[model samples]
Target: MAGVRKRYGGKRALDGFDLTVERGTVHGVLGPNGAGKTTAVRVMTTLLRHDEGLVRVAGHDVRDRGREVRRRIGLLGQHAALDEDLGGRQNLEMFGRLHHLGARRAGVRADELLERFGLMDTGRKAVKLYSGGMRRRLDLAASLITEPEVLFLDEPTTGLDPRGRAEVWGAVRSLVGGGTTVLLTTQYLEEADQLADRISVVDSGRGVAEGTPDELKARIGGDRIDVVLHDADRLADGAHALAHAAGTHAVSTDVDRRLLSAPVADRMTALTETVRALHARGIEARDIALRRPTLDEVFLQLTAARGAGRPGATERQEMPA
Candidate 1:
């Protein structure tokens, strides 16, 4: 996308947004609610036209070559679009036909998808009777009817239980295995961390950060060290000792919980040194652990920077779970 813009009166849905996804990789578009995520996908899939800038999908300009672009892409929106009155197999068959597959081929493809999605037994059951997970599986199967080279999944696992989310993740892995390029928009940070080859974090109406999960995480700092003391009264002492050992203002003490958390530039070596120092001071830790910062931490740091009255601030409010 180039200089893409969309407006609803005074509010801009997408403001000069741009994104580029490489082929045969899972590219995650992440953002909070009311960000341009949905709007960007809409423009890329030809569902909504951009007021400015060029949009392209699968090498076809979305505006001028919409039909060609549509033929190369399959889309699964945030909500499943299965017809409740139809059987799971029937829904896939109908989509196959819509993709221009003949009767015999469409039926065969539907059966194949049903088996692949582990819904062969329920293929004859009306989608209305299907559980949320099963319905989402069928919706995904329908989207794959044409076997398009590019797939657009917008929060495909939203509202799913853990098992359902796992099922979707499995399906995404399978798609990537088959060399299908996927453009996924999701609010789930873990989902993006687990599946995406590269991530582009969008907020408000523009891309805020883009990189691999590890690279993004590394931007915030390094490993974290947490120590729990036997007595709450020792928290302040532990904080001071740990902070002194770490050579940085890395300590945060929780008096009630008797916990001290400190950022260690090198946790493996620093943590052991801190533990030895505490022991020498006659302090005993009930528990201790070293951990890498998660994507959530990185996101917060980046968004917080933008929120601090920085130039080009566009981070939006967090998305609803």
Candidate 2:
């Protein structure tokens, strides 16, 4: 949407927000609290209106043609919506009926979705008895009763444990594998790192950064060579060794963690050289690895960049409306 705008009394919730998601790809929207990720999703899904700019989804404008857009998009909110007293299949069938499918077709669609989500065995089981993962799967299945073209998932995996999160991630992968375009909003950085084909980092009602996970990670700096020293007191020496090996004075040390991090050009060569130099100098290291910057680091740096000089301001420089 161009020049999209939304406000809450005196505050701008979606101030000059802009985003473009391609078809058939899972686009991740990420930000910290009060970052306007939710507001942008609301405007895009037609749940809330934007005071300015244009939003086109599936070739239909969200403002003037909301019904057409709604028909093509399926939304799964943060929490699961399943009746505890009803069976899994019953809930799916009920959603199908609500989507205007006849009774016969609804039953067939429910069974199809149950099998697709690996819930066929528990189809007759009461939803309350289903595990956290099961409930999430059922919720996702309900959203697919009509097989919408674009899916909006607002934190589809929120409070689940590792297993439940994995199950939900698998379900999302399956949907994308079937050629569904998904716009996922979540606070989990790792989830975005794994599932998103591309990610948009939003802050203060605007997209501050956007790119593939790797691309975004690369922007923070370059490959990082990390060394964990066996001796806590050797932290300073380790940082010195890393700085020398990297041919630069840029090195960071976390004394509490006994780790030193530095940017490296030739990953393996720099790592090997550092190891050799440290060994020669008798500065023993517990472990060493050459790796890219983590998503957490990239996110921190990007968000910090947004506030580098300019504090949060009410007015944002305009783009083409």
Candidate 3:
């Protein structure tokens, strides 16, 4: 997408949104609520047209080559769109027919999908009788009926339990392994970190940050060293020692439990010095670990800067429609 914009009356849903998804890779679209992630997916999937900008899916122009684009792509919307009255197998067969596949081929494909998605035993059961995870898997299977080259998944695992989410993740990994290009829009940070090769964070209808999970985390700052002391009275002492050793105010002390967080530019040196300092003061730490910044931390840092009216605030200027 290039300079994409969409409006619901005067309020813009997407503001000059631009995203580039390379072929055969999982590109994660991440954002907080109402960040235009859904709107962007709709435009890319050709379900909704952008007021401005060029969108190409599978090398077919979304505007000028709607049919070609649709043929090459599959979509699983935020909500499950399944025929409640129809059996799972029947629904798959119906979609396959709509895609113009032969009856025999459609039946075979439906059965294969049922097994692959762990729905084979329940294929004969009505969709309304299926569980939430079953319904989600069925929706995903429906999207793959056409064997699309490009897949658009909008918050695919929203209501799933841990096991169900894992199943979906496995299916996604299999798709990518077979060289399918995926555009995933998810509010779950761990989902993006686990699956996406690159992530683009959107906020308030604009791109705030874009990079691999590690790259974005690195941009925020250095490693975080967290120490948990045995006694609450050692909290202040731990904080002071960590601050003097780390050369930054990146320390947070919890008096109740004697927990301290210190930012370390160099983990090895910081850990060594912190251990020595704690030992010298007879402060016994129950636990200590150096943690890299999480995607959530990176997102908070980047979006916080934007909210603070920092420099490059409008670096991604909204293009005129």
Candidate 4:
């Protein structure tokens, strides 16, 4: 999308938004509430109209060729879109038929998808009888009935348990492995960390940052040097020592648990310096380690910048489950 703009009354949902996704990759889109993530996806998937700008999917313009765009893309929304009363195979076959496949072909495709998604054993069981993970898998299979080139997943694992989320995550990996380009919008940062080859951070209806997960994390800050003090009383002394070692006053200390954290550009050098400084100051450390910033941190930094700049910015709400 280029210069895409959509407004609800006076509020702008997308302001000069832009995103470029290469084929056969998992591209994750992330943002806090009301950041225009859902709007961008709706425009790209032809579910909503953009007031202005360019949107092309699978080489077709989304504006004039929405039907063609729909034909090439599959959307698995936040909730499972399945007939709970129908068996897994019946549900898939029904979807295939809706995609214009003949009855014989639909039955054959149902068997293939059932086997592919590991639902063959429960193919004849009603969807309501299936577990949460199984129902989601069936929903995914239904979306794939037409063999789409691009797939759109909007918070695909929102309410699932850990085991259920893992099942869906594994299925997503399998799709990308088989050369399907997936655009995922998720509230859970870890989901994006595990799935996305690249991520776009959106805020205030604009694309604020876009890069690989590691690249984005590097933008906010680098590896951190954390020292867990042996004594709670030494927290102040440890912070001062760490600040001296890190050459920055931006040291954070937790008094109750006695944890001191500081930003470090050079991991080994900082670690060595902090260790020596602690020894010289008669401070005992229970643990000292260097670790990278998490995706959650990146999300906060990006969205915080936007919210700070515009206090009353309109927020987005996901379509109710």
Candidate 5:
């Protein structure tokens, strides 16, 4: 999408947004609530039209060739569209038939999908009886009944437990391995870091930042040194010592937890020097370690900065699920 703009009355859901995703990879779109992640996906999948800008999916323009775009894309939305009374295999077969695959072909396709998603053992079980992960996998399978070239997943693991999320992640990896191009929109930072080959962080209906997980993390700083002290009163001293030791005065401290954190140019050398500095100052630290910055920090810093700078902007609500 290039300079895509979608408006709803006085509100602009997508304001001059731009994104490019490579083929046969998982491209994650992440944002805080109402940042236009879902709106972007809807436009790309042909479910909603943009008032301006260019969008082409699977080599067909969404504006001029909606049918061609729809034919090449599959969408797994945030909600489940399955019939609770029907069995797993029955659900998939029904989807296949809806796509005009005949009885025999639908049955064969259903069985194939069931096996691929590791649902054959429980394919005959009613949908209501399946676990959250099982149900999501079934929903994912249903979307692929026609084997679309590009699949759009809008928070596919929302409200799922860790195990359930992991299950879906594995299934997604398998899909990408089989040459499927996936576009994922998720609020979970770790999900984006784990699953996305590259991520585009959107805010206020525009692309804020885009890169691999490591590249994004590097925006703020590099390795960090965390010093947890035994005494809360020494927090200030610890902070100063760490700033000097790390050769930077940009130290952050937590008084309640007696922790001091700062960015370091060199991991091992800075760690060694900081430890010596604390020892020389008779500061007893409970623990000290060097670690890379996390995606959580990156998300918080980037979104907070954007939110604070934008004026006359009320929080936008996402489209109804």
Candidate 6:
């Protein structure tokens, strides 16, 4: 969608949103709460209409070709849409039949999907008996009943444990490997960093930034040095020493963790000078390490900038579950 706009009364839900996704790749959309991530996905999937600008899906205009767009795309919403009374195979077969696959064809497709998602062992078990990961995998398989060209997964890993979330990640990677283009909106930053080849960061109903994970990290600066002080009282001193060594005053500190952090231009020189400065001040550090900026920091920095600059900005409504 280019220059898309959707309004609810006086408030614009989507304001000049733009997104470009490459085929056969996972593109991640990220934003703070009420920043229009879900609204954009709704428009692209033909679930919502925009008041202005061009919106298309699978090469067909969504405004005039909603049917064509729906035919090529599938959606797995935030909530599970499975019936606990039905077994895995029965659920998949039901979905296939609903999609207009005949009885024989639906059964065959159900069997195929069950095996593909490694649910063949539990295919006969009731969905309620399945694990969270197994049930989500079954739901994912059902969404592919028609072999759609594109799939929209909105927070697919929500409410899942670490293991369960990993299971869904593996399934998504396999689908992209088999040539499915996926547009993913997730609350977990690590999930996006793991699965997305490229990412788009949105805020205030607009596209704030777009790039690969590494590229976004680069935007916030590079190679941060974190020093965990052995003494909490030495926090201020450590921050000052590191700031002088790094040649920048943008030092951030966490008093609760007794941590002092700053960005460094030259890794080796900065590390060497930091140690010397701390030792000269007789300050003891428990640990020191150099690493790249995290996605969490990038998200906070980007969104906070936009929120601070806008006049009369208030928290927008979150998308419906």
Tell me the TM-score of each prediction against the true structure: 0.92, 0.94, 0.90, 0.94, 0.96, 0.94
Worst 10 residues of 3 by lDDT: 311-320
RMSD of 4: 2.1
Q: lDDT by residue for model 4 over 165-215, one digit each (tens)? A: 899999999999999999999989999999999999888788999999999
Task: Please tell me which model should have the higher lDDT, number 1 or number 5.
Answer: 5
Comparing candidate 1 with candidate 5, which one achieves the higher TM-score? 5
lDDT of 6 by residue, 1-321 (tens): 899998776777788999999999999999877778888888898887789999878899999999999999989988899988999999999998899999999999999999999999999899999999998999999889999999999889989999999999999999999999999998799999999999999887899999999999999999999999999999999999999998999999999999999999999899999999999999999999999999999888988978864423323353443
Spell out the clash pairs found in candidate 2: none
lDDT of 6 at 63: 95
Instruction: Residues 1-321, candidate 3: write the lDDT tens digits.
Output: 888888766667777888999899999998766678887887888777789888888999999999999999999987888899999999999999989998999999999899888899999999999887788889999999989999999999998888778878988998899899999988788899999999999876778789888998889777988899888877888888878877788788877766898778889998888888888888889998999988888878777655543322221232223
- Give each prediction's root-mean-square deviation over alpha carbons: 3.4, 4.1, 4.3, 2.1, 1.8, 2.3
Model 1 lDDT at residue 89: 90
Better of 3 and 6 by lDDT: 6
What residue pairs are clashing in model 5? none
Local accuracy of candidate 2 as per-residue lDDT tens digits, 258-297: 9998998898889888988799779988889888888998
Q: lDDT of model 2 at residue 131?
A: 96
**lDDT per model, in order?**
0.85, 0.87, 0.85, 0.90, 0.91, 0.90
List of clashing residue pairs for candidate 1: none
- lDDT, candidate 4, at 260: 95
Top of the candidates by TM-score? 5
lDDT-based ranking: 5, 6, 4, 2, 3, 1
Instruction: Give the worst 10-residue stretch by lDDT in candidate 1.
Output: 312-321
Evaluated against the true structure, the overall lDDT of model 1 is 0.85
Q: Distance (Å) between predicted and true CA of 178, model 3?
A: 0.7
